[model samples]
Target: MADTQTMPVALVTGAGRGIGRSVASRLSAAGYRVALTARSVEDLAGTAAECPGETLVLPGDITDPAFVDQLYADIEAAWGAVSVLVANAGAGVSASVVRTTDEEWQRMLDLNLTAPFRCLRRALPAMVERRHGRVVVIASVAAKIGEPYISAYTASKHGVLGLVRSAAAEVATKGVTVNAVCPGYVDTPMTDATVRGIVEKTGRSEQEARSALASKQPIGRLITRDEVADAVLLCVTNGAITGQGINVDGGAVPS
Candidate 1:
């Protein structure tokens, strides 16, 4: 058996809830000393409580470059350089290209694309030096295809997917692997918000709106948080799975 103190260290961003929380718990169960981060201290505390193994909770806004730098520094100070990074914190906004305000467009790019890029930049050098690391970005099916009223969100996800592919290629010679997990309409608070928006805009009942979203997946259900976490763990453990976006979308956007 391996020493608990020598367990691999994993840092999961946006870990307060949803897929991030599930990923953190899953990694902890897999014997990783997981570090959890998000903007909400209460939420991070809740996630840390659910983790079965050791956890370090750090709360902050990952979109801020300074915070991203400090986040990596703090994690390194606590548990050396992270051997696994799950960049799962992101937000989506629905608007037609014409209706999307500059602020909203930038928000999507900042939180979903640029923030992950910053985290990757900060984490990759140490990982390359160690020649042992895994990076999984929690992207969306939006990254793989175009959809109405979500142009900005799609653009951001697509950009992050490109980032993952490029980074994976750059570090393939090293022992590091970079991948993205693309989930579709996950049953999380984020999807709850999307359902609420549909109800408000289309006058659909809550159940009807939810079913409509679920029907988008051929499986007729929103993807589960645990399912997405499973994909992340696969990327973490499989050295040959680099530069791939494993879809947990129930066959929604088959590529």
Candidate 2:
């Protein structure tokens, strides 16, 4: 319902909930007109309520090429150019390498890797042409390190780093900075569902599985959504930094 097209515009995929919602809220509070896009309109509505400025609720399956095209077109038509793009829409599947089906692997890549690619493809041209833009991908710590049972998720997150580095290199000189925020275990509905899966599969108590997941981080707790959002805020707001994956993992994958 926001009609302010002249304000600086931001497009946040997966902006309905979780870290995406936090990013959108932060950006809106910082005076950008935010576009919230996710699969659920109702979820987007919740995020929209938190934004301080004008908000456009754009709901769709970002993995579809057609939807990506229209999303960019609509944003451009409405707001002139997309100033910030937070490619935060992704999903993870838990499976060992040998037990993982081709369908599972492909699904992970389609959403985590290729969907961002499509968004970037549509978003970058305007940024490149204008000589000003920010691209932030919500990657995972699985990108930098490996895990035992989630081969598909790990590989896809790794692929995200490749995309981030290559694109950042190409656009670094153009005033369009590209980077990623890699989180270890964030407290979100997604993580809750993951906890449920662990309980179901391993027959461990819910509390034990949750503890085990949090134990990966030296801080003995899951990362907060706002913690991840802070890194993204820097990536999009600061012009100098580029081609990096800032880990918000509480020393989980330290050097």
Q: What is the C-alpha lDDT of each candidate?
A: 0.93, 0.92
Write candidate 2's Cα lDDT for 1-255 as tens digits.
Answer: 545655678999999899999999999998898988999999999999999888888799998999999988887777778989999998889988899999999999999999999898888998999899999999999999997989999999999988999999999999999998999999988899899999999999999999998998899999999999999999988999899988999998873
In candidate 2, how many Å is residue 19 off? 0.4
lDDT of 1 by residue, 1-255 (tens): 668667899999999999999999999999999999999999999999999988998898999899888988888888888999999999988888999999999999999999999999999999999999999999998899999999999999999999999999999999999999999989999999999999999999999999999999999998999999989999998999999988899998886
* lDDT of the structure predicted as candidate 2: 0.92
Candidate 2 residues lying further than 4 Å off, grouped into runs, are: 1-6
In terms of TM-score, which candidate is strongest?
Answer: 1
Candidate RMSDs in order: 1.0, 1.9
TM-score, every prediction: 0.98, 0.97
